[model samples]
Target: MSLLDHLSEHHLLVKYTTKNEMEEETRDEGNIRKEDQCNTVKGLKKNWQKWANNHSEYQKHNPFSNNRTVTVQFQKGEEGYGRPREGSRTQQRGHSAHAHLEKEVDELCMIIKSIGEAGGDGQTRVAFGPLFERYVPISNKLVGVLLRARKHGRISFEGEMLWQRRDDDVIITLLE
Candidate 1:
């Protein structure tokens, strides 16, 4: 008997199997008689309406429906396709300073511990230039490190002139 007749007799959905799937079945399992599979579908029901309802529900709530395309225009001599565009000078400086501070956190903590241990007072006094020379060998990232340390409750200003002092001038005490 034909495949459609076999499917209809057992209440199986003919649309569920594509032409490619049917071809693959014929090529791969040709030795197994269709009657054996057809007999096994005795209690199965062909519920096309239920499948259609589920598909409609899935399409309604699909996230890809909200996706939109964005276009960026690049002018002449502007590097856009390959390399990243440079940020504003102030923003770049701030980001680099912040990164430098983060990199120096452990070293700064160790310096504070050592200074506090050496000093007579329980708090450690850290001046920018000496601290910078001690910890950061290459660049002066002491201001950012001290500011971040202050924000994190690791240090605080000792005097009233916090931001007014020169690079080598400001002294901050380590918090216990």
Candidate 2:
């Protein structure tokens, strides 16, 4: 967590607690002077503004224009091609998993469109069996991508969640 996030929530607990609890908590956490926090925040803002004001020419210093392959996962302390050193928080899980998300989604869409059965409402629907069998080889992150696509209203499935082999017959419909 950043200093900003820590400062916001840490100070709120003492305000809500009883006198005894507050005193105990304060003793445990140690006393933090508000002035020090304010000065630190101000210093950060001033430094950031100074850096932001100096806009170098794009032709001279364009980081993204570099041509090199960058792998997804690397052990801590190793840097990749053209990657920023900005203290990235997300490490193992979440956003790091979806490298070729667009291609995966396109392949999934094409697979469902090809093998899906027609529903009574005239929508193309495929069983989880076909999707799993076909897509797992293409991209092992099929389930995660499916959840992402569903979150964005691209597809709809009938159940709380889909399971391998168990929910093979569960129908999943591609939303047009």
Candidate 3:
């Protein structure tokens, strides 16, 4: 017997039932002509042949020559795949720099608040030169902290023009 006949006889071949047949099965039984059933089977056979041919062509082009399979090497007590235990020096430095910047931002906020309170206007003008000297030694780092503070609504600029300029002498008013 052919492979199709053998599979069909053993009920191993998956039967493709049409939507109408499924709907009719849910309602009442209806008689279907033998020719129509034969046509459906022929269509399913054609679809299967097309799919098989495409798959064969794909395999021919992308043949799996290597028998080796990659296996993950995990440390003792490791559960699943994740980030490596030891990170690069740059990553460590970045984390340290971020932490340092956060500390500087906190100090800067306190200084700005104190300066604003002393002025009795709830606003204080801060120049970059003094800010760099007082809170953060690095000018760029101080700028980052100030930008972050402004973004979080902790501070506001005096004017629109102040944002575009970041000169050492440029003065910015911090508002509570």
Candidate 4:
């Protein structure tokens, strides 16, 4: 057989001794350090409550600003116009793929810039006040997942074959 099987086959004495000896071995290194540092299953609930309290305070102190102007722009990288015009199926797959690439690029650029400013360590978390602290981690993780996905699989529209071909090319134009 194999090394493990051979050992078990012959070494009956060791197996019997080993099983009983290790059975009572204390594996629960509970909180190894202290309440603040050691995060475990039991600690998760405890820490979450603490974090919840801090977050509540943060929200109370810093109200969200409604005065900031949101300007939507259109181009490859910026938020507004890069997206394909709505309801147009022309090169939909290609457009979507490019859009995904552009989005990933933008996200990576932002993360890298942040990381650089944060000294390339996981130490300083940026705070655009409390609003950013709440969303940055989740947003970073989402972008990371998307970027990783783009590396392997191709994005394409699969289902729904709509619009039969006309005798000549049928061109439709949309106005914004």
Task: Write down the TM-score of every candidate.
Answer: 0.36, 0.44, 0.33, 0.20
Residue-wise C-alpha lDDT for candidate 3, range 79-147, written one tens digit per residue:
733432245464688789779867766777787655443345756776655655665543446666778
How does candidate 3 score on lDDT?
0.62
Clashes of 2: 0
| Candidate 1 TM-score, C-alpha based | 0.36
Off by over 4 Å in 3: 1-102, 114-120, 138-140, 158-166
- Candidate 3: minimum summed lDDT over ten consecutive residues — where? 61-70
Residue-level lDDT of model 4, residues 18-121, one tens digit each, is 66554543243342566534357568898899998966654443326342444333557676345543544645877887788667645544543454233233
The worst-scoring run of ten residues by lDDT in candidate 1 lies at 62-71
Tens digit of per-residue lDDT, candidate 2, span 1-176: 99967886787764656778766876865677778768987999998887665433222334364524442444566775445434443333334555557567767878888988878887889989988998888778888788877887888998777899999998899986
TM-score of 2: 0.44
Report residue 12 deviation for candidate 4 (angstroms): 99
Steric clashes per prediction: 0, 0, 0, 1
As for candidate 4, its clashing pairs are 74-81
Candidate 1 structure quality by residue, lDDT tens digits, 34-147: 787776565243466567786665545443554243335466777753433355354688789778666677678778677544457667676755665666664466666677
lDDT scores in order:
0.62, 0.74, 0.62, 0.43
Residue 111, model 1: Cα distance from true site in angstroms: 1.5
> Highest TM-score among the candidates is held by which one?
2
Q: Residue 67 lDDT in model 1?
A: 27
